[model samples]
Target chain A: MIDLSQTISSNTIVYTLDMVGVAACTIAATILAKRLQFDVLGAFFVSFLGSVGGGTLRDLLLNRHPIFWLHDLNYIHFIIGLSLIVQIFYHYVERLDKALRWFDALGLAAFTVIGVESALSRNMSAPIVMLMGVFTAIIGGVFRDIVCRQIPLVLQKEIYITASLVGSVYYLLLLQTGINEWLRSISTLLLIFSVRMLAVYRGWNLPDITLQPKEKQK
Target chain B: MIDLSQTISSNTIVYTLDMVGVAACTIAATILAKRLQFDVLGAFFVSFLGSVGGGTLRDLLLNRHPIFWLHDLNYIHFIIGLSLIVQIFYHYVERLDKALRWFDALGLAAFTVIGVESALSRNMSAPIVMLMGVFTAIIGGVFRDIVCRQIPLVLQKEIYITASLVGSVYYLLLLQTGINEWLRSISTLLLIFSVRMLAVYRGWNLPDITLQPKEKQK
Candidate 1:
C-alpha cells in the first residue's frame, strides 16, 4: 500500500486533516443539536461554533489577522452545507452516538496537532505551544457546550483533555528528536486518537477533586 | 459643576471610562461569585472574564494585535487587585445588589462606546460598527454566565442588549450631527445609562417569542 504521508507534503497532509477534523466536529455538533431539539438556526449556529470557535479563539489570542473562516469562505460554505444536510437527515443522523465518538476523537487528534503547528509557526515557547494545542483541541467543544447551557465536557471529569495534553507534549518531544515530518505528524495524531478512543472504551475519567471543609465539633 | 469631559481629550475620556467600566464589571462579577460561594481563584477567573472578555473578543474579531489587556498590563493588575479586594469585602459587597445594577449599567454604556470607537477606527461600516458596540457591551456577561452554567442574561427576556443596541444607533446618529466631542460622548453615555436604569426600574422586558404549533383537531 502506498504511504500517503510519504508522498504528500506535510502542510498538505495537515491541511487535509484539518478539513476532516472540522467536518467531524460539525457533524458531531449537528447530532447534539438534534438531540437537544434545537431549531435549524440553532443547529447551524452550534455546528459553526463547534467547527471553528477554537481556532478562531486561538488565532485571536495569537494575533493572527483575517480569521481562518473569513480568510477562506470555503470553510464557511462547507459548514453551512454540511449543517443543512445533517439537519435534513436528522432522523437517521441522531442515532450515531457510537460513530460520533470516533469522529470527535479524530477531531481531537487533528486539531491538537494543527494548533501546535499554528503556535510553532508563531515561534511560541514550548509550554505555550502545548497549551495552544490542547486549547485548540477542546475549546470549540467548550463553546458548543456553553452555548447549549451545559457544563463543558472538557471541564468535567473526563480523560479528554489529558489525552490532548499528553499528545501535545509527545509531539513537542518528537520535534526535538528530528523525526521525519510526516511520520511525526501521523504518529502524534494516532497517539491522541488512540488514547481518546481507549479512554472512551474503558470509561476512563480524571479524578474529581472536591475540597471538604474541616468537620466542626458537634 | 465642572464638565470633566470638556477638559479631558476624548481619547482620555474614553480611556478613563474604560477603566471605570472594567472595575465595575469586575466588582459585579465578584458579587456574583460571592453569591455562588466560589473559591477565591474561581472568583478571580470569573471577574477577569467579566471585565475583559467582551473587548478581547471584539479586538480579535477586528484583528487588533496584542489584545487590549496584553498591550497594557495595568488592566491585568487592576482586575487582580480589584477582585482580591472585593473578595475580602464580600460581606459588605454582597449586600450591594441595589448598587450593582447601577455599576452594570455604567459598564454597558462605556463598553458600547469603546467598542464603537474601536470599530470606527478600523473604518468598519455603520451596521457592523453598531454590532461591534453591542457585542462589546454584553459578551463579558455572556462569558460569565456561560461559565456559571446558565443562559446568558442578554439572551433572556431582559432589556439589556436592547439598551446597548439603541445606544449604539443613537451614538451613530450623533456622529452625523458633528456635535461637540465631549457633549456627544456625555449625552450618549447618559442615554444608555438612562435607558438601562429605566428598564431595570420599570422591570421592562423584551417580548419572548415562542412559536406555537397549529392546534391539532381533537
Candidate 2:
C-alpha cells in the first residue's frame, strides 16, 4: 500500500482541491437532509456519510488502514464546520436551488481525478482504475440516496458515471504522456466537470436499457 | 491483519457454515434480481455483491489484505455454482415463499458468528467486535436492498440487528468462561438464529423514531 498520508500531504494542490470536493459533497448532503426535514444529528450523519462513504469503500476495497478521514482529523473537522454553516444558512441555500447541481458536479469531477490518481499510483489495471474512479465519484451519492429512500441518481441520471469514466481514461492517457502532474490533474478535473455540467445543461444521457419484444421471447 | 487463510483452513465447521451463509445471501440476491427483472449480467453482479458485500466491508475495515473471497477461489466458484442452480430452479424457489426468511435468518446468524470470531481472534475491543459482528450480518442485505431500490429491511423491519448484537454479546461473554471453542460458536449461532426466527414469527419490531408534539418544539 502507498503511504497515503505522505503522498496526499505532498500534493498540496490536489489535497486542497480534493477537500473542496468533500466539502461540496457534505454541503449537498446537508441540503438533501434539510429537504427531508432531518434533525441536526441526522443531517450531520448524512453529510458525513456522503463526504466519506465512497472513499471509505475504496480504501476498504484496497485494504488501506485507518481510512483517509481517520488518518487526518482535518477531514472530520472540515465536514463538521461545513455542516454547521449549511444549517445556519439554510434559508439562503434553499433560495439558491442551482447550487446543488453545480457543487455536485464539481465534487464528482474532483473526486474522479483523485480516485484515478489514487488507483493509478497503486499500479492497478486500467479498467479497475477507471471503475475505482467512477466508484469514488458516485458511490457516496448512491449511499446517500439509498438512506433517503430514493433511487441512486448515478444509476439513473443523465451522463453521470460516463463523465467520470471519460475523465479517468483521460487521466490514464495523460499519465502515459508523462506530462506535468499538476497540469494533467487539472486537465482531468476540468474535463469531467465540463462534461458533467454540459450533460446536465443539455440533458445528455446514456441510452437506457429497453426491452425488445422479439428478444424477450428468447 | 490476522492470518485469515490459516484460521479459515483450520476450522472446518465454521468455514463450511460461512460458505452456507454466503450461498444463502447469493440465492436471496438472485431471487431479488429476478423480481426486479434484471438481465443476466445485472443478476450475477447483484448476487456476487450481496454474497460478499458485508464481509468485504468488514475485511476492509479490519485492513485485511486480498479480502476473504479473493484469498479463496472456492467462494467465487460456490457463488457461481449456486447462482446457476437458482436460475434453473427459479420457479421452484418462488413457490417456496417462506424460504427467503428462513435462509436469510440462517445466513445472518452464521455470518455473525464468523464475524465475531474473526474480530475476537484479532483481540479488538469488545464493542468494536460486536459492532463488526452485527455489521457483517446486516451490511450485505443493506447493499442488496439499496441496489434493488427497496428500503433496507435492516433499517426498518423486525428485530434484526438487535438479535445479531445480542448474539455477539453472548459470544463475547462466552470468551470469559473459557469454554470449548466449538461450543461457544454453536451457542452464539443458535442464539441469533432462534432470536431472529422467533422475532419474525412473532411479528416483533424495534420501535421506530416518531416525533412528539412537545419534542418537535424543542
Question: Lowest summed-lDDT stretch of 10 residues in model 1 chain B?
Answer: B208-217
- C-alpha DockQ of every model: 0.12, 0.13
Error of 2 at A188 (Å): 1.4
In terms of DockQ, which candidate is strongest?
2
Identify the leading candidate in terms of TM-score: 2
lDDT of each: 0.83, 0.82
Writing each residue's lDDT as its tens digit, candidate 1 over A1-218 gives 97866666877888887888899889988777766766554566578788888998999899888677654667767887898888776666666769888988999999999999999999999999999998898899888887777678787767888999999899999999979988888999999999999999999998657766678422
Q: Which stretches of candidate 2 lie over 4 Å from their true place?
A: A1-10, A215-218, B1-48, B61-63, B68-139, B146-218
lDDT at B50 for candidate 1?
92
Clashing pairs in 1: none
Instruction: Please write out the lDDT profile of model 2 over residues A107-171, one tens digit for every residue.
Output: 99999988877777676677668767977887888788878887665655467878888999899
lDDT for model 1 comes to: 0.83
- Tens-digit lDDT track for model 1 on B67-182? 98997999989999999999998898888879988998999999998998898888877766776787798889878987787666565445677788788898889999979877
- Please give the distance, in angstroms, between residue B60's alpha carbon in candidate 2 and its true position after superposition: 3.8
